[model samples]
Target: MNLVQLKMLDAIVRTQSLSKAANALHKSQPALTLAIKKLEAELGFELLDRNQYRLSLTEKGKLFHREAAQLLSAQSYLTQLANELALGNEANFKICYEQLCHAPQYNDIICDAFRQYQSTEFSVSSGKRFASLEQVNTAQADLGIGPWFDLFHATGDLESMPIGKLDIGIVCANNLVPKRVKYKQLQDYPCLAMFESEMSFDSERLSYSKGSAIMKIDDIATLKSFLISGAGWAMISLAHCQSELDSGLLQRVEVLDREHTFSAQIRVFRQYSVHHGPVARAIWQGFKRASEQFIND
Candidate 1:
């Protein structure tokens, strides 16, 4: 079947009405109906079920919709690649993050690697975590560095390599702690939390639990600012706070009777075709070498 027909089918399934789908695709309702009729006749299956103003996909249609999305994505990638080739050597790269990259040590190492490989010649910018990943999967980014969540593994063709791992900890102001602190004690005091879209571990969803009025912040900069100012204790990456920890600017507040540590893996995932580029190849090699030495040290 033609790509247009498949796209129409996906749109109908997504929008759930023939008129809505037609409006979305910018096509007349009758034309869309004809396309859908021809597709169903050719495939010999009922693709959609309509009831009044609503439409629902049949089992076969649902299966086809999934495959259609991937096919469309691949086609879009090919079109972008052609456009990039027309633009000559001004390559582009995107970096996405769940939180702002304020960790001086990690940032320096990444920037050093980019300079070592002359990656600075290319374009780089930060975006929201999932949007950044979508750019990478769509041939928009050469590399992505961010925190790992369960949904990250579901990207079909993107290969992920966890370059290094760092543990997350609670960052408390110096005056707040003379020694180790207890997790139970946090219940008695105000705490700050950074909220991302989907909470990964429901049973262990600590922030949502009843405690001393949790303050929800959307960005890392504000979260860190509040913590350093002693607004409240915050959960943060140890690697990000290492220098602060050593300098007495920030101290680790041990909770849960033990360290509540989660490993943050700096992963690099790329499309096989994109890896063929000179800049992409150099950055890959540099990150690999640096990650090895980082873990060992």
Candidate 2:
């Protein structure tokens, strides 16, 4: 049978119900049934037992299932290999930045280039402040933008470029808390802590022992929502949360330690590959210009 028929068989087997598989695949139950019946007829053997109520694969079905999965996995691997070969270092330029504040500016530059040259595609993801660098090392990401720290100093594997620095502050629902606060005073209230990837965390500095009552989260977008909902106060870049603060939707909690700034740097990195494709070179040039403007602004 074809890949579609095999996929349907596998989905039905894993889900244990034709109706559930049909719903998940966004196909009518009747269409799914016909596909299964067709597969069975072509094989000259029963693939499923309808009387059991639970979808159970027959002996032939089990044999085909294993083979089908192997085939699909091989196909997926081949596609990824082709994509990597074609795109090279420009396959994915990952950036770790404040979703609300930094993303807009980054998107503007990248999208503008896309509109003009239309030469590459981008996929963006978010992580805790520390994880961005790790993503670069793992080849899961090609670039990163986040708080500057000593991680790069130790590894001697990355190049950190300073972008525009933004002041970090506590954000809360308007009128929900005092306009200003002391660092120690923060222990009295719940704090929304955004955790970075495991590889990014510096066990010495990021542990809960520091002082605030923390509710940790890994997703950047979700963390913003919690602050907006007034569930808790969180540390965020002032540039990112300015609109909310100005609109009275969220209140800025000024902390006593004004000098305790988190310096943000956009670090562009790649493996020491001898060959960087045209797309990679073009994107890297764009990023360099973006960083220059980012720091200047």
- Model 2 Cα lDDT, one tens digit per residue, 1-297: 888888788779767899989986799999999998998899899988777879898887788888987786566557656776775534444444434335555566556555654445666676665665666654566665656655565542565556555567667888666777666665577778776454534553654225656778877668878888887787777776778888999987766754333545444454342234555456567777877887678
Which regions of candidate 2 are displaced past 4 Å? 1-101, 112-121, 207-212, 257-261, 267-274, 294-297
TM-score of each: 0.68, 0.59
Model 2, position 64, has a per-residue lDDT of 80
* Cα lDDT for residue 13, candidate 2: 79
Q: Pick the candidate with the highest lDDT.
A: 2
- Candidate 1, residues 1-297: lDDT per residue as tens digits? 899998899788766778878997899999999999999999999788765457887888788778887887678667656755665432554555445333354455457656755523555555333444565654556666655555766653666655566577777788774346566666676788765442223223555224666777766667777888887777777766678789998887656575565666666566653424445565667667766776786
- lDDT, candidate 2, at 75: 67
Against the true structure, candidate 1 reaches a TM-score of 0.68
- In model 1, what is the error at residue 258, expressed in angstroms? 5.9
lDDT on C-alpha atoms for all candidate structures: 0.65, 0.66
